[model samples]
Target: MSTIELKNLVISKISEVNDEAFLLAINTILDSKSESILILSDDQKSSIKKSQKEYLEGNYFSNDSVNEEMEKWLKQ
Candidate 1:
C-alpha cells in the first residue's frame, strides 16, 4: 500500500486504541531502526565514511568560514 493508505490505516487503528498507550506505542513503532537496510552507491558510502573519519580526527572548517559563505549567498 501507498504511504497515504498506510497512514490512514494506522490512524484508524489508533483511533480505536486507548489514548494513553497509543501514543507511546506509535512513537516506538515510528522510531528509526538502526538495523534497517539502506541502498547507497559505493562512492556515496566512501564519501560519508571519509567525512566521518575527518570529523573523528578533528579536521574540520571553522564556523566562521561557513557563516561567511552563508552570509554571502544570502546577499546574492
Candidate 2:
C-alpha cells in the first residue's frame, strides 16, 4: 500500500483500539518518531574523537586478549 493509505489505516485502527496499555505503547512509538535530534555534550564529542583516533592508531586490545580477560573475569 501507499504511505498515505498505510498511515490512514493505522489511524483508523488506532481509533478503534480501547486497551490503555496498547494505546500507551502506540503513543510511545509515535512520540519516539517525533523526538528531537540529540545533541552530544562536549565531553561526549571529545570521547568519540579520542576513540576514533585510538582506532585509527591501532591502540586497542585484540579480540583474543579481550576474550581471555572476559573469561578470567567470569571465573572470578
lDDT by residue for model 1 (7-64), tens: 8998898888877877886767676554366889999999999999999999998899
Candidate 1 global TM-score: 0.37
* Clashing pairs for predicted structure model 1, backbone only: none
- Provide C-alpha RMSD values for all models, in order: 12.0, 4.3
Against the hidden true structure, what lDDT does model 2 obtain? Answer: 0.95
Give the residue spans of candidate 2 off by over 4 A.
2-4, 15-25, 32-38, 69-76
Query: lDDT tens string, model 2, 1-76?
Result: 9999999999999999999999999999889888867889999999999999999999999999999999999999
Error of 1 at 4 (Å): 17
Each model's TM-score?
0.37, 0.55
Per-candidate Cα lDDT values, in order, are: 0.87, 0.95
